[model samples]
Target: MSPPKLVFYVTVVVFAGVVIFTRDLLYLVRTETRYGQLDQYDHAVRNKHHMDQANLKILRAKAGLVHDENNIELNLTLRFQVNGGENEVRQKLKYVDKTVKTSKKEAASQGEITFETPSLLTLFTTWSGKGDVNARTHNFTLRNWARLKPEVNPVLFIDDGYDATVAQRLGWKTHRIPKSSINGLPVLKDMFKVIKDTYKSTFYGYANSDILFTSNLVETLVHVYYDSFYSDNTTLVTGMRTNIVNLTEEEFSTQTTLLNAVSTRGQLYMTSAEDYFIYAAEYSWSDMPEFVVGLIAYDNWLVLNSRYREDHVIDASRTVTAAHHTVREPDYQSHFRENAQYNKVLFRKMMQFHVEPPYEKGFTNCIDKYTEFVDKKIEIRSRKLEDPCLF
Candidate 1:
C-alpha cells in the first residue's frame, strides 16, 4: 500500500512541474511578440519622419531657398532682372518649422513664389520752409518715413538757406538741389538725376512732403521687386493719395493711430493727383524735362514719359496707403506762379514732341498694370484702360 501511494504522488508532482514550465514558456513568447510589434511601429514612425524632412528639403530648394543644417535657417538667392537683367541678390532669412508644412501649398496656389522681407529703396522729397503748418506737416511726414528705417533711405533736397536740422536729426540725408527754376524752386529732373547719381538702391522714389506712408510702401516695393512683370523692364510705380483734412501731428503719434485715421477719417483723393512716384533704379531720366516740384503738371508728365518710353507703369493704389495731410489748401494764386506755369509749358512741349494728342496721356487712369491683394498676397494684374494711347 505504501509503494502505490509514493508512485501516485511522484506522478502528480511531475505533472505539476510540467504545467508550470509550459506556462512560463507561453509568457516568454507573448512578451517577445509584444516587443517585436513595438519595434516595428517605431521603425515605421522614424521612416515617415525622415521622408517628410527629405520632401521639405526638396521643396525648399526648388523655391530658391537653401537650408542651413546647423542653425535651421534658410538663405534666399534671388535673380533680378534689373539693369539689364543680370543681377543676383542673396539674403539670409530666419526659418520657422511651420514653413516646411506650408511651403508646398503656397507654391502651388500663388503661381509665383514670394517671401516677406525688408527691401532696399530710396525716397526723396523737397518742401518749402515758409509756414508753421508746412513745417508741422513736413515734420509729421518725415517722422512717418522714419518708421521704414534700415530698409528705406530717405533724402531731403533743400535749396540754399533752408533749414534741414530736423530732417538730418531724423536720419535723412540732406542734399542741396542740383538745379532750380528761375523762381528758386527745385527742378524735378535734376532731383531725380542727383538721386540716381548719389544712391545705390533697388528702387528710387519721390513724394510730396505732406504725404505719409506706412510699412505697406516697403512691402509693396518688395512684391514688385520679385514680380515677373517688372523683372525685365523698368517700372514706374505710382498711387493715389488719401486726403485727411486738418490732420495734426498728434493725430498720428503712432502707427496704429495713423492707420486708424487713414481708414476712418481720410477720403481717397482724385486719381488725377498722385502724391508719390516710385520707379526702379534702371529707369532713365536722361530726357526728363525741367519741370518744377510742388507743381501739378510735372507729376502727370512723368507718368506720360515713362509710358512713352515703353516701361511698365503700375498703379499701386490698392496696396499702398499714401496719406496726404491737408494742413492748408493749395493756393489758387500760386497756380499762376511763374514756376508753376513753367511745368505746364514743359508738359505741353513734351506732348508736342511725342506727336501725341494733348489730354490723352499722363494720368493714373492711363496705367496699364496694377498691384492688388489676392488672398492677402500681392499680385500683379493687367488693367484695361479705356481710350488708352499707344506709346
Candidate 2:
C-alpha cells in the first residue's frame, strides 16, 4: 500500500478509538457522580442540621407527615419564613427527586433493568359502592399502574349497581361481575376464571378498588417472571400498602408527582394480604368460598387458601408501593357491619379447627426481600398471616 493511504487509514482508526474512549469515560463519570449525590443525600438525612425544628418542618413536608395513633398530627408547613424562602423550599422538593431517582437506579441495578415482562400481564380490579372521588382516584391509579408496563392489558369488573362508563373511559376492558341477592357477591374463584377466560395474558392480578399501585410493582413482577425466580405458576405475590386521605385529581397527572406526594403526605399502614394478589393465569385454585370480597374475612380467606394449597405466597413489599386512597367516611364504615362481622367470626372458626382444605402441609412463603427461586424446593418459613410491617 502507498504510504499516504496507510497514514490516512491509521488516522481514521485513531479518531474512532478516541471517540469511543471519550464516550465511555463520560458515562462512567456521570454514573459515579449520580451515585455520589445519592450518598450525600443519605448522609445529609443523618446530619445534626436535619434535626433542627426549622429544618424539620421542611423535611416533614417533603417526606410527608404521619400523625401518631393518639391523633397528634405532625406539623408540616412549607410556608415557614426561612432565610432563602421559596428557593429553599424548591431545594427541599428537589431533594425528593434525587431520592426517588436514587431509589430507581438502585432498583434497576438490582434487577438488571429489563423494561418489559416476558409475557403480557392482565391485571383486574373489582369495584362496588361509590362516591364522586371513587372513579377519579381509581382511574388515576389504574392508569398509573398500567404505565409501569405499557404491555399490560387492564380489566375492570364492576359489580351490579356500579357505573362502568368511567372505567371504559380510562381504557380498561370493562365487564360486570354478576351479583345475586341470594348468594350476595359473585364467587371469587369464578371471577378469577372469568378474567383469565376473557383476557389471554400470562399473569393475572386482583386488587381492591381503592388500592393504588406504583411503577415498582410491574417492574418487580417482570423481574420475577423474567428469570422464573419467584415460584411456579401457582405462586401468588402480595404486599403492604401506604394510605393517603383526600387525594385530589391534580396529583394524578404524573406518577412521579403522585408518588412524591405519597412519600411526603401518606401514612404507611399495611392491611391484609387480600388488598393485592398476583399469580400466573394458569393457576387452578379450587373451591374458593362463596364469601364475597367486601365481606370481612374473605380476603384473609384467600391467603389461607393459598397456604392450604401449598402455593408460594411472596410478600413483595420491597418492590411494591400499594397506596390506598381513603376519601369518604360512610363508604369505609360499611365494611365492618353485621354481615361482615359474622364472616370474620366464621373465618376464625375455620382457622381454629383447620376445618377447611384438610391439607396439613403449609405453603412456602417468600416475604420482604426479593430473591431468585431455584428449583430446589427449599423449605421457606411461614410468617404470621396477618402481621403487616411498615415498608
Candidate 3:
C-alpha cells in the first residue's frame, strides 16, 4: 500500500477510537462510584470513564432517549421460579414474562422494571410436609416461603411429606401433584399452570430469596428497565454470580440447555448457576434445583435473560458481601469446612455468598444483607400492589 493511503486509514481509525473513548469518559464522570464498585467485574465492570462512555453510547442507540428526563411510573410485578417438569417449567416462565410485559407497560413513559421476589413462587412439596428425610429442609423452606408471600397461590405438586395443617399454615391450596422421585429434581414449568389456574392476574416476577434491596433498588430498576431509553431487554439481574465450570450432567443438565439458547436480545447469558440447576429439577433422580432451571432454558422453554442478582450466601469466609444489607457477625467459618469442589467453582465464578467473605467478614454480615434485601423487595412489591397498608 502507498504510505499516504496507509497513513490516511490509520488516522481515521484512531480518530474514531478517540471519539468513542471521549464520550464514554464523560459518562464515567457521571456515575463513577457506581461503576467503580464493579470495576473488578469482567462483564459488568471497567474503568469508570469507560463505562460512563459505554452507557452513554447505549443510551444514544435509542431514538427518543438521547436527552429525556421525563419521569414515568411503571408497574412492578413479583413472582417466583417453579421447578417441575419440562412442560410445567416452560409454562411458568412464559407466564411470568407475559405478566411483566403486559401488566407493567401501561405506566411507563419510558417503562418500569418489575422487581421479582425469589421465593414468591416456590414449588410446594411434602418432603417437609411428607415427613421424609429430605423434608427436614423442605419443611423449613416451605414454611418460610408460605410466610413471605401468602397471597401467591400454591399448587401442591407432591403431598408425600406435608400435611393439611402445614399446608394451611403456609396458605397453600392442595394441588394434584405429579409423583416425583425422592432423588429427582422437580419441574420448573409446572408452576405456570398453578398461576393460570389460580390468579386471574397474569403478570408476576421471578427473583431469588437471599437478596435484600437498597431503598432505591426496586424503584430505580423499575424506572430503568421500563425506560424507553434502554434498548436491552435482558437485564443482568445478579450483580454477582457463582459460575459453574465442571458439572456433572445432573448439575448443569437443565441450566446448560437453556442458557445456551438465543434471547430476543441475542445470546443466552447464564444469569447465574442457580437458575441453570433450577431447570433440571424435573425428571431429576437427585433432588437439586440447579438442573431444573438449567434445563428449562436449554429446552427453549424460556429465553436466556442477561440480568440477574445475588441475595444468598454463596460462600462463608470471604469478607466481600453479596448484597447491600445489614448483617450480624458469624465466626463459624473458623470451625466450618468448605467443600473443596465448591470453593474451586466459587473462586472461578468470583462470587461467594452465604460463605464468609475475606478475613473477619462472617455470618452476621450476611444476615444483615438478607434482612435488607428481603425488606426492600417486600416494600417495593407492596407499594406496587397499593397495599403497603398490609404491612
Q: Which candidate has the top score in TM-score?
A: 1
Clashing pairs in 2: 63-264, 64-264
**Candidate 2 C-alpha lDDT tens digits along 1-391:** 9999999999999999898778667755664664465446544543423366776555533322321222121121111122333212211111011111223234333422322222246777676644434666666666765554334567776665677665566667777774432235554666777877776655787777778765445444544554333454677776555667787776666656566556565554423334777887667756665555655556656666766566666666444567778775224453655465545555546653332321111211224233221221111223443211211
lDDT of residue 283 for candidate 2: 76
Which has the better lDDT: candidate 1, or candidate 2? 1
Residue 163 in candidate 3 has what lDDT?
62
Which stretches of candidate 3 lie above 4 Å from their native place? 1-131, 134-136, 150-156, 179-184, 202-271, 275-391
Model 1's alpha-carbon lDDT is 0.66
Please list the Cα RMSD from the true structure of every candidate, rounded to 1 decimal place: 32.2, 25.3, 19.7
Reference-based lDDT, residue 181, model 1: 80
Give Cα-based local distance difference scores for all models. Answer: 0.66, 0.52, 0.28
| Model 1 stretches with alpha carbons more than 4 Å out | 1-119, 130-133, 329-339, 353-357, 388-391
How would you order the candidates by TM-score, starting with the best? 1, 2, 3
Give the per-residue Cα lDDT of candidate 1 at 287.
Answer: 82
